[model samples]
Target: MKRAITELFNRLRFKHKLFLSYLIVIIIPIIVLGVYAYKQSEQMLKIQGIGGIEKNVDTISGGINGSIERYNHSVQTIVYNKTFQKIVTNDYRDLVNLSYDLKEYLSPYFTMMTNLDKEIDEIKFYTQTYVPEYGESVQLASRVSEEQWYKEALKGTGSQWFSDNGIIVVSKFPQFSNDKDTNIVYMRINEASLFNNVAALAKDDTVIITDKQGRIIYSNQQASAAADKPVLNTAQLSALKEGVIDFGGAKSYLVKKPVALTDWTIYCIVPAAQLTQNAGSIINATLIIIALCILIVLIIIWIFSKTMLRRVLSLNSLMKRVEIGDLSMRVRSESKDEIGELTNRFGSMLIRLNEVIDELFRNKIVQKEAEFKALQWQMNPHFLYNTLSFINWKALRSDAHDISHVVTTLSKFYRTGLNRGDNIIPVQDELEHVRCYIEIIQTMRENSFDVVYDIDEAVFGYKTINFILQPLAENAIIHGINRKESGRGVLRITAELSGGKVVFTVEDNGNGMPPEAAKTLLESQSSGYGLKNVKERLQLKFGSDYSIVVESEVDQGTRMKIAIPA
Candidate 1:
């Protein structure tokens, strides 16, 4: 199966392969992200919608409970008042005097209760005794035992609610003087004012207030006809919980909370579709934008893949030409892309190959010339040594010690410098060559400076480049000692083995060059031949790892340090 798949992929063109890759890498991810974002947004909207409805229900329930509490307090005030209680319990035969006393005692309590709450329209006291007829605010009951609310009020010990003419709160008064008649006191709140808070909700939302038996009391939809009022039948009400409901042919969020003072439940109903409308619109817009972006990206990929393939095919054809001995062919491209970089590298490789061929051809000619020069050097050095030996013998015979010493030093210097035509020699031999060169310099300058050696014996057997030290000593004598102002000049050569490397330093206590001059000594075009020659040779032999370091301060001294692998 894998072999078949590979063969099929190889047969497809490059552009088709790139298109397939774009579908996987770009198109698939966009679709997945859009779907995931929609789901998350939808869930968030549902939670927030339900939470808002619950808060509204809780707020309305709290306000209604507070209004009911105030009404109850009003009822209790009349029941416990000493003045009104006295009037109700006592009997008087004088109707005018009795009416005046009753009004005077209860008028103040009535005025305060009515003014305290807008919901309390009237406060009434009903009794069988002789009382003046003072409208509905204070009245006498002709037959009090016949009313249902009156019987219900008698059954309970405390305050009770009833829907007679309006919502009435009736509380029974105790029989103070052992009479067969019972006195009842009630406060009536208008039905419209009772559910005023719920009516202030949004028009689309429905609020219903129900008694403990699940019978509707005050509803925001009460203005509608009885048939049009929202009804949750017993079965639907039983099915309804606290969160969401799907009754009445519509989906809605339901919030139910019971009023604390009264056992009435307040329901806030919000439609589900209204809550998530904005989220749905946003999701649709996002999917459209993603689809448009994917279209643009695919177009760009098609154009870019074709351009890139053309360059690659061009490079392939050039490589074929070079394979068959056509080295003159070259690729030219102005682009800064990877393919252009490949062309530049190929061009550089060809140039280097040509240079190497030319260098090999020139080396053959140089090799023969070196052999001829070697033969000439062998003969000329023998003759020069013989002549120097003859000069030394004659000076010895004539008892000229200075001349004999000079000739002998010159002979040793030449012999060590040659070193049988080998580039590398022992440290001891290089040091001996420096000593001979220094003797000649001292003789020529009339001993202007002194030479000192602080070399370690262990480094004497180690190999070093020949003639490295002699040039440094010559520079010290010619440039440093010859230019000193006052104090006696001193030349010091030291060598030691450190960290598996040989370090040789040539120091001179003579007139020193400036710091800038010392720093550029090796690279300066005006620098003497000896310093530049030593720098180049060290770099060529050790590939820049070994080098010469020069440190100098004006009028102080100069120090040249050479470090090489031991």
Candidate 2:
């Protein structure tokens, strides 16, 4: 089985391998931990549900017991009151006088006791004597044995408790009256005020109070007429003594405690489903979070694998191109890791190979050009200079000074341009050469422009490539000065030694080119050869350290700066 699994893994692609790695390293462990956490959480919820139900039931039971004890105390107080007993057993010949006496004596005691406790609603004295009602608070009854509560009172000795529909505490006074009639003192408790606290405890549950005969007299849901039915039958009530019961088609937790004063039982019934609602919600939320986490992790894994493999495939494609003799192919990477280093090395190898091929090709053309230039230079200059000098002399003898000056300047321009077949010459000679070229331009243009020279004496001895400044001056005059709408221009040439370098500038106050046009002067195919030739020769001789920079703006004129190492 292990061999089969290994074979399957080996047959998969790199992305599949990465997915398997994540499943083992991240997903499986999370799933295991999530299952364990779910089980532990379920167990914890069960224990907590049981504990919480038990606590609430104990609290409600204690509150109910305390209320019964307070009512029992009230009953005992009324039963032993001598004033009340005397008022009940008094023999009055004048009925009006007796009624007045009853009110004066019993009214004060009932008012004082009932005022101290708001739970007692009515205090009544039931007897066979002719007693009129004093007020609604204290009642005098003529029939003692007719009422059900009175009959129940006679069955027990002291403080008999009964609730037919509402709570009543009845106590009989036998010693006070020797007649066949029995006098009873009973106080009816205010049902709402007596059980308000116990009812509050059953917010989402059910609380029921039943009499000794298992008849439910009070309930938390008493306001709802539909809930008036008995919740537990006698069999279920008997079974509830063990702690829990299944009744009314729902599993419920039952806590039953007997009220010592009334022998009634208070039952707190909580549904099993209600107890676990919060736990179920929590488990569902945890499941959603776990699923989202797994999805996010899978997305991250896919993106990472795709990015890494794409780079590797790009390098492989470039290698294939190189293998097919496309040596110009290169990998472009900015990373500093091992893959980036490999890409860089591969790119460097291609660059070197291309450079070797380019050098060999350039050498052959250079050799042929050098031989042709040497042959052309041997014949052209001497004949050209002699012809120009003859013209100058002939013009001078004829008293044509302008013609003589133009031919003389033209001769000097060509002589200096040759520079005795040398590539590098003194800075003074190059300046003199540019001056001659500018003079010829002035003569041809009817001297419409002015030329200024600002040369530092210290840089006069510095050597530079011949014809460098002459092309720049010619470019300024032809492209810049000649195109001006004003037709009047100024040309300035300056040279200075700055920071161990020879800085030369050729500037013109004329119509200037746009910025894009100025940038393309060095790179444009349509740009003339003169400026490009000078730039190339400078780079070839002095390496890339020396360069010419052109700055121009429309209507702002143009300036060209040439920098060479001193």
Candidate 3:
């Protein structure tokens, strides 16, 4: 029994186990939500009623915004015509003529505005006086020299619009191309019709625009005397003005939007229960779905869990075999389920793991051989040469001096190459090696060429791949100077610390190689001793990100600089 439980535990995926757990946890409770066990019908009726109200109000709010947008477009067209622009653009003489002709040009606007009176109680555009005592109805043109909107438009600022009373209004000032643009035309809006349109258009609720005092400036539904009566008092408007709210008694839901550049809020109110009637139905249906889903899951899990458990347990045993060093083991599955997918992934992982183990052993043996080869290749001729030099010195003291020159050349070559077994030696040490090689060559072949070393002291501390600089200098000496037309050739070597890097250059005043030859020499094949080996070694150690720039002209000198990362 314990073995079977262990097998089952290993066989099941985490997600399937979680699903089985969820079925046990939620199956009973979800079945209960679907029951709707409440006996009271009144609460149910209220829920259904309020839900209907929300749907109605949502529809009304959508339409009212559309209607308002349409009216705004019409008002914009009437006030910003060409005639308005022409009159406003005129000189002082034209201004006097405009004052007379403006009323005729503006007559169409007034005519359309009067038609709104049929839908709304009243519409007026007025300028306010500091003292209402002077006259209750003070005309806008009388008190202010210019309206605020006209002032803006006069400077070619563009059109202006506002909503007041129950109407939407717009204004446009005239433009004078010769000087500045001004608003000479002021078209009044009738806002009362805005509320009338809202009330008429909104099937489920009322639309009203009011001041802080809660006076109804516009009602969209009715032009009757009752339209003038404010539905909400100052107190109720105060609540609406504060913001949108939910009234629990009415099961109401309210949404409000405030107009930009204004204090007024556009509020849409509806009963909450009505908005979610469909969602409530969906919620109830979801309870049923959940119960059904759980029961089906349980039945399916019971039927298939044991069969699945068998195959996975089989795979588990195979994996254990592999874990215990049986790399030949593999799991086989035919079904396309979560367990099957996982087994497939596991099989691939096992194959790769075995391959990696085999490759690792192979690499170990190869690395051992490489280390042996490198060891055999390292040579130190220094000891033999030094012993020979001591013998030569003793013979010279004994009056046999011919052997001294041979001993000296061999010693120089040996000591320079060996360098006391130090791999990363100083550049100065490298220069000494080059000097010894030159001396050896001079003695052997009677080679005579000028070699000058101009090295800076700052770069000695840094470690480098040894023999890099020496070969460059050697190549220059043997190939460049030896082949030159000039009888006396010059080999100039210079190095310095430049911008935190060691800049070592060896330039010989020999006949510089042609473009193709110089390129081939610098990037010589692996079989040859040239710049290619240096470049590859530097790249393998550092990366391609570091720069090796080579600049040369045929007759001119070659400049190669290695730029290392800071």
Q: By TM-score, who's the top model here? A: 1
TM-score of predicted structure 2: 0.37
lDDT, candidate 3, at 72 = 50
* Candidate 1 per-residue C-alpha lDDT over 1-566 given as tens digits, one digit per residue, 9 for 90 to 100: 99777666555565576677666657665676666576655566766577777778778877877778877777777778765665665556566656776567567667776786677887777876655556664567665668877877777866678767678887767665667666668788878887776777645677777775676776655442253436665456656887777745678788888888766778777778877776545557567667867776777677667765887888888878888877766556655556667877877887787679768856754663464336336557888899999999999999998999999999999888887777688999998999898998889778977888999999987899776887778777767887888888999999999999999999998889997888676776444436776776677666577878888888888889898888
Of the pair 2 and 3, which is ahead by lDDT?
2
Model 2 lDDT per residue over 428-483, tens place: 88888899999988888888999999999999878987778987898899888988
On a 0 to 1 TM-score scale, where does candidate 3 land against the true structure? 0.34
Candidate 3 Cα lDDT to native = 0.54
> TM-score for every candidate vs. truth?
0.39, 0.37, 0.34
Writing each residue's lDDT as its tens digit, candidate 3 over 1-566 gives 99776567556775766676557555655555445444223355545545454454444444445544554555455446565344434433544565554456544545555575453222223322221211221134343356443343334433334433224344444323554432322334444433444564445454545433345444442432243423444467556532234443454555554443333455555445445555545456556656776777677666556665777787888888887889877655654568777788888988899889889966765664454335324654555766887888897898866457656755665565556654455666666666666666566656577768787777666655444565676667656777777578777767687777677777877667777876776576645445665565455445765534555566565555554322
What C-alpha lDDT do the candidate models reach, one value each? Answer: 0.75, 0.75, 0.54
The list of candidate 1 runs beyond 4 A from truth reads 1-13, 19-379, 444-446, 519-529, 544-547
Provide the lDDT at 464 for model 3. 58
Which lDDT value does model 3 have at 62? Answer: 49
lDDT of 1 at 356: 90
Task: By lDDT, rank the candidates, best first.
Answer: 2, 1, 3
Following a full C-alpha superposition, what root-mean-square deviation does model 2 have from the true structure?
Answer: 35.4
